[model samples]
Target: MLNILRSHRISRFAVIGGASTLVYAVCALALSRGGTGAAMLPATAASVVAYAIAGLFSYAGHKYFTFMSAGAHAFELPRFALLNAMGLATAIALPVVLTERLGMPAAIPIVLTCIVVPLVNYIVLRRWVFRDV
Candidate 1:
């Protein structure tokens, strides 16, 4: 068990994932808060921006550290963008829809989204985006 944990690329992916989540949180907070007394952006818009910023870090980290891909980034980046788009849609759209339509607390859906998005992203990244060349 310990050997599997130490040897698996999933461990590396999880590390990069933690970093990416941190990036998203920082960017989202900054954008949504909008600095001392300035008008804040819509929450959905702020979250989308944050996801995009984290996507860049995700691509670089997975390419270099997680999957160790040496493929041309010209090919990889587009695929990575597509993956991130799906995740962004899930993260932003679900929370807004659940809050607006079903009357659930926005935080509930956002927290759920955070869990689901990473699991899906890990599968997609391992099988598709960062697959061995």
Candidate 2:
């Protein structure tokens, strides 16, 4: 089973990425919608919070499930953190730019960010973060 999964690395990453993206979207929607009637928080702020919360799950899932990285935390964690920081920035900034700046629908940027981040993350994780594995 492990060997089969190891052989299907991209499939495993898609599964984990789907799960983490779901987590992030749910949290972002809840936080963005659950506030005062007229004075709701901006989607960017909500996205940041959501990404931070979901990021914990993402790191674990990618390390153990997607990449199966047994690398040292002292090394990998910082790299993962950097990558996640880049992801978070994209997740937050896209929504803000698309929705607030461009007058697009909120969902547009949310969906775009979700799609774009996973692709970039997969490449980075495969080529850099989990390369030693």
Candidate 3:
């Protein structure tokens, strides 16, 4: 347990993931609420936009910091983007299926999306996207 707690990659992931999640959650909530001068967006729309914004940060952080991989960007970048596209799909679909179809609140879908994306992403990033690490 202590060894697990001391893992360098996990430590880096926690820092990077926290920052990226903050970006995602803030954008999502703001867009959903139409904060400032922005027009209100549906939960699904907000999520897609948020995921796109966050994906960039996540990619750079995971590639350079968390995984510390020396793999060619040409190979890794498309794989990273593809994985994030999968994450974005989850971010979009959770709101549609949970809030629209099941009558749950927008908040629930957003929170669930936040939880699911990172867990799945970490596994895939290790196994495929940043496999060289």
The best candidate in terms of lDDT: 3
Model 1: CA > 4 A from native? 1-7, 33-39, 100-106
**For model 3, how does the per-residue alpha-carbon lDDT over 37-133 read when each residue is reduced to its tens digit?**
4438877898889889999999999999998889999999999989998888899889899867886767787788888888898888889998854
TM-score of 1: 0.80
Candidate 1 lDDT for residue 13: 85
Give the candidates in order of lDDT, highest first. 3, 2, 1
lDDT of each: 0.76, 0.84, 0.84
Candidate 2 lDDT over residue span 1-133, tens digit each: 9878666998889899999999988887777763324425687888888899889999999999888888999888899899999999898888778867987755677788789999999989888888785
How well is each residue in 75-131 modelled by candidate 1, as lDDT tens digits? 888898898889998878875787556766544555666678788988898788877
Could you tell me how far off, in angstroms, the CA of residue 108 lies in candidate 3 after the best superposition?
0.9
What is candidate 2's CA lDDT for residue 51?
A: 91
Q: How high is the lDDT of residue 34 in model 3? A: 30
